[model samples]
Target: MSAGLIDVHAHWLPAELFGLPSGSPYGAMRDQDGELFLGDLPLSIRTEAMSDVNAIISDMDAHEISLRALSPPPFAFAVNSSSEDYIDEYNASLSKVVTESTGRLAGLGLTRLDDASAAARQVADIAKAGVLAGVAIPPMLRGASLDVGVLRAVLRSAAQHRLAVLVHPMQLPRPEWSSYYLANLIGNPVETATAVASGILGGVLGELPDLRICFVHGGGCAPAILGRWSHAWQARADVRAGSSIDPRDLFRSAYFDTVTHDLAALELLASHAGEDRILCGTDYPFDMAEPNLPAFVDSTGLDRVALQRSGKAFLGVRVPQTELQ
Candidate 1:
């Protein structure tokens, strides 16, 4: 029983998801001469790698990943009522892939974040499906922060169903970040941090103690700014206006992925968030994905066994000690 790594942050977008019905929000998505385009905006991703399950497994074997959790990319999230049908179709298709993976894959379902009630119902359906381990949501929905709008219902439903939540950033373009690809490089991490702050400061985490949520991109910039947040929370009434829980305390309860792309940063995150709460992750099939995830984890000097356990714990998958050992 060799101890193999579990990746909790890889993505899978089946080719069938691209064939959206006419009324869907992303219905215009089409492959144009080998490039994927959504309404003429070219998406920069490896379509072949994202759509091929056999290739994904071969890559995982090559990279030494034992199991990979699959989630639809953020673009597949339902932003409007018109997207409900498409999102449902997407989740159904994703479940099929999971069923055929023979335990090599787990899936995270997507929901219609634009409508809280609909999203909550979808969360229930996702749990009832039994093949999905969690739900994936964007950190922001339609220009508002996640903590503000329909997310509360979604979070509560996920907690009730014991479904872990993965908060991935949408990477929407901003005027200031228009050039230099800052939308992805800088905006992504900041968006993740904002969601974490919202969860902690907005009383969401305190309200639901059973929620198992993991933030990706090494929890964005949240770990690095804990001290500053603690200081402000202690000194400013406005900072503690709604929630009295300590930022550092609740932040520790949350989970983070190992995608910092820097050893010192990973070490800092471990120091702040505790190594036991860290999980292995590779933003697979993307340009920003860690090229050598296993080697990168080894380079960080963190315990690989602990990370494997954390990933299993996040997905609520329990394995015997003998198997892990």
Candidate 2:
């Protein structure tokens, strides 16, 4: 990179997360080898990137990455029959990783999103953790949209603290999405777009101007498909009749990550979401995540200043003007 990088979309799930013998929200089966099956999803902890912290730090050193904004994988935010302590323990585990990363990691906290009032309290608590960068949420929590009144209080709390809201999808919206793993490849972007749309179309963005949300997965389909959404919004009077603000501009005002893994997609994202509103992201340790994002971003024709500004804006990381190296 010639400078430095901060991977905003990295994960650091402890290998023992599924092994805890407490009140788990979901049923998990552990085999003799410690391989796990949490519901229908299988987890392999033997992977060096997923299991070994030292290996992760060494990789960051090799990649010239100064910091990693770590969050638990999306399943960690599942809203189920889980108790509050379960959530607390998980978030506490997340916080400890940040505290132990030797200033090389920024922790993105996790919170409950099913009920607005409870969600608000959790957001405040996560912010008070002091090392928290922001909170990451599933596109929808227990079928409640991001713009619903059920999430208003949480959003308000986040706005008050200037915490970044990372909108990542957790479930496929349809039953047939399991085919060929289309959900992760295509449904994820669709869900991300849905997340932002819920915010803008439901008036959350207009009501909370101070809120900073960064949609990962290259902003899903929201940025690139703005024209289609705008057209749909314009073509229907009922759609335009409710919103008090221009949904297009509101969506554009949001932040995005450079995780598209395609040069053209990143270009479209920068064009719409603003060049300064993007952060470096690779969806690290996931197969779909960019294998070498810094080099890819460097090749996207963005000069050093633009790159530095975008990274700083999305993650609030201070990039010195005299170059980041």
Candidate 3:
């Protein structure tokens, strides 16, 4: 494993958050046949791997990943409710995991998006905790865009604290995307693209210039539509109503993870977003994750070392050069 190989996009769930009893304050979650289900809907499979720190570290070692930044998957965000208590418990559990990893893991805390002021306070608390590199947020809050109202305050707080923000998608099942797992394969990317557009066209990126936000899944479909957005920005008045910042420039300023699952697509993203803005991400322990991230990047013909450096920059942490034995 390269000493500086760091994965900025990965997920971890503490055992305390799952397998809940009926009267639990955080709601009931059950583990049925090794699959985690919240109510009648299945939340995730591979529950063991998600909660097991040792297994995660071993998998990272096997895949030549020297370090990983862990966040709870979007399902754990509890975005539908104003449940700061659950968010607090989740972040506290994650901090303990980071401390136990012995330099192999860094944590990204969770925040309740329903309350903007509370969310900002959570960001401040996460920074003060001194163990988390950033915070993970869903692309939407209660069916509205991220830039809609008070959400911008959350982004502003993140920037002021110098903490990175991971914009992951927690896609709800739509009627049109019901079959063939389109909810994840198609809905997820669309959701991410929506968030990216909202951030750019709505002026969140321009307002918070210091915010270090990274979108996963190769920034969804945002890269492919940059030219169209740029054209609309220049040719249409309504498109320019929200903010005067060019969508292309705002897109370039943000960071993206290498999870496009295509060499040409990744090359296109790096070319436009700049090599320094591309970070290594595996979406680890999920069935949709890249099975062998190092090998996949090597096949892309992009510079792995540059991606390593980009991961370091996004996290704002210096990882020592220590090769795995």
Which model, 1 or 3, shows the larger lDDT? 1
lDDT of model 2 at residue 221? Answer: 83
Write the residue-wise lDDT of candidate 3 on 50-78 in tens digits. 87898899888888888899988777776
The model with the greater TM-score, 1 or 2, is 1
Evaluation by TM-score, superior candidate among 2 and 3:
3
Which candidate has the top score in TM-score?
1
lDDT of 1 by residue, 175-275 (tens): 99988889999999999999999898888888888999999999999988989998999999999986889998888888899989998888888888899
Per-candidate TM-scores read 0.93, 0.88, 0.92
- lDDT minimum window of 10 residues, candidate 2: 20-29
Q: Is candidate 2 or candidate 3 better by lDDT?
A: 3
After superposition, the stretches of candidate 1 with alpha carbons farther than 4 Å from their true spots are: 19-29, 32-44, 319-323
| Stretches of candidate 2 exceeding 4 Å from the true structure | 19-46, 317-325
- The better-scoring model by lDDT among 1 and 2 is 1
Model 2 Cα lDDT, one tens digit per residue, 1-325: 3767767887766666654324334454343354445565665433557656787788788776777788766766646633566568767877777778767777777777556788888888887777677888777765666777555667788998778777777645467786888877788988888888888887788888888877888778887778876787888876665476777788777878888878888899888777777777877776677777667877887654565566566656555554564
* Best-to-worst ranking by TM-score: 1, 3, 2
User: Per-model C-alpha lDDT, please?
Assistant: 0.83, 0.72, 0.82
